[model samples]
Target: MTTQYGTWRKSRLSEANGACVEVARSLRGTIGLRDSKAADSGPILELTRREWTMFLRSIRAADKIG
Candidate 1:
């Protein structure tokens, strides 16, 4: 699927500690993720809505466990 992404935005919680990520939504409703530090040259990881939700849940669960 050809994706046309909307505005990519970084999380406000990401301070200058260097662990930054940016996220955007494509016109077709997929999620786009990239490293904010290398945004212009880095690779993007796109995911469907379901994948995005699952990814979030897994990470949150892992965070709680760690």
Candidate 2:
């Protein structure tokens, strides 16, 4: 299925060196992720809201443990 993302937001931790990913949310509650540097031509990675939350939780847990 094809989904369209409206607005994309980049992480505050993103550097000025153009190495970062942008994330957007669709009306259907799906999350869209893509490269910030190549916003137009890059491939997008889509995930469900639950999956996105789990992914973020894992990253946060890893940060706490490490």
Cα-based TM-score, every candidate: 0.87, 0.88
TM accuracy, model 1: 0.87
What lDDT does the true structure give each of the candidates?
Answer: 0.91, 0.91
By TM-score, the best candidate is: 2
Q: Compared with the true structure, what per-residue lDDT tens digits does model 2 show for residues 1-66?
A: 778888999988888998998999987889999999889988999999899999899999999999
Cα deviation of 19, candidate 1, in Å: 2.3
Q: What is the lDDT of residue 22 in candidate 1?
A: 91
Where in model 2 is the C-alpha error above 4 Å?
A: none
